[model samples]
Target: MKQKRRVRVMVAKPGLDGHDRGARIIARAYRDAGFEVVYTGLHQTPEEIVEAAIQEDVDMIGLSSLAGAHKYLFLAVVELLREKAADDIVVCGGGIIPDDDIKRLKESGVKEVFTPGTPLDDIVKWVKHNITPRQD
Candidate 1:
């Protein structure tokens, strides 16, 4: 029997967000939950994040933004993925985002948004239910 490919997720910190404690924790949670995880350290541009996601052939991108640039930075990643025709890679975000912006983010192509205090297990379960590893 052929084994299933593990979900591959890229957790990224976009823009000038200097905070990464949450990103680190979630990366660990995904790893512990049996997903293949790649974490891009702090101070990453949306372009850098998108490029890394594509190169890594990730099934999804979990962008973390603590610095108030989620409106711009997060959308940029989604847009870049579309431009690159890699929109098949699911994009989601979390961290310090205002509830008001969450609606906009979702409408703009982000699959989901997780605010503060969201349980790690919930996030993992969402990934398991929503994402499938690339066959290639």
Candidate 2:
């Protein structure tokens, strides 16, 4: 029997957000949940995040931003992925984002958004239910 490929995900801190505790936690949670995780450290640009995601061949990207630039930064990553024909990679975000902005982010192509205090297990379950490893 052929074994299933593990889902590979990149956890990124986009923009000038210096806060990374949450990102780190999520990365560890993902790793512990049996997903291959690549973490891009703080102060990453959208371009850099997308580049690393593609290079690492991640099936999903989990972006964290506490700097209030989610509107611009998150959308930029989605757009770049489309421009590069890599939109198959799922994109999601979490941070101090407002509920209003969450609606916008979802409408703009982000698959999901997790706010503060969200359970780590819930996040893990969401990934397991929503994302599959890329076949290629």
Candidate 3:
């Protein structure tokens, strides 16, 4: 079997949400799973998050939001990445979003959405399997 490159993932909290327990947990899990991980501190704007991802050259971005603004904030990050020609970076979200919103979020460019109770192993496995290796 071919060996996949180690994935680099950025865990970010967009918008005014100050809660970060989940994001931290995910970041640590990614690290333990042998993926490089970056965690952007809380209250980051979409632009800031995208900038960090580009600077760090991450393979994927995972957003966690509970401020009831996941739709706008998550989509904004995806749009910024698209505008920067960095759409190759896989984007995913996790939080208290409703099932109805998850569909729209995916349509807006989020590759997947994880609800509050999703297992970290599932998230790690999904990312490892789904991320497209960066060529540059």
Candidate 4:
């Protein structure tokens, strides 16, 4: 029997965002793609997201933030990831993000940011294609 490759991911809903249908969809997609995913329900703080990632030892952190607070949430998460020295985890997701904001977020340690309407296969491919072991 072939051994299954393990790829743990944390799908989190950060900040004051309450809507979660999208986050749930992405979680199911990742699971169907054979990844072990940890879903952090709505209202997660940046600290909670990072702590969950570290504790769960996830390979990626997928956030669904449509509350227009991605700037604050993403920046805090990035800073905490750096503080915890777990910046290797690939962070990616989609939402109602503006085009220019997407570029800014990438500079702050987000590996990839998907815009609305991105195919599920594309997300799975992105994780499989870019997720790598931590350099530490």
Provide backbone clash counts, one per model. 0, 0, 0, 0
**Once superposed on the true structure, which residue ranges of model 4 sit more than 4 Å away at CA?**
1-4, 133-136
Q: In candidate 2, where is summed lDDT lowest over 10 consecutive residues?
A: 127-136
Candidate ranking under TM-score, highest first, comes to: 2, 1, 3, 4
RMSD to the hidden true structure, all candidates: 1.2, 1.2, 2.4, 2.0
Root mean square deviation (Cα) for candidate 4? 2.0
Q: How does each model score on lDDT?
A: 0.94, 0.96, 0.92, 0.86
For residues 12-101, could you state the per-residue lDDT of candidate 1 as single tens digits? 999887999999999999999999999999999989999999999999999998889999999999999999999999999999888889
lDDT of 2 by residue, 1-136 (tens): 8988989999999988899999999999999999999998999999999999999999999999998999999999999999999999999999999999999999999999999999999999999999999876
In model 3, the worst 10-residue window by lDDT is 127-136
> How does model 2 fare in lDDT?
0.96
Off by over 4 Å in 1: none
**Clashes in candidate 3: how many?**
0
State residue 28's C-alpha deviation in candidate 1, in Å.
0.3
Q: Give the higher-TM-score candidate: 2 or 4.
A: 2
Better of 2 and 3 by lDDT: 2
Q: What is candidate 4's TM-score against the reference?
A: 0.92
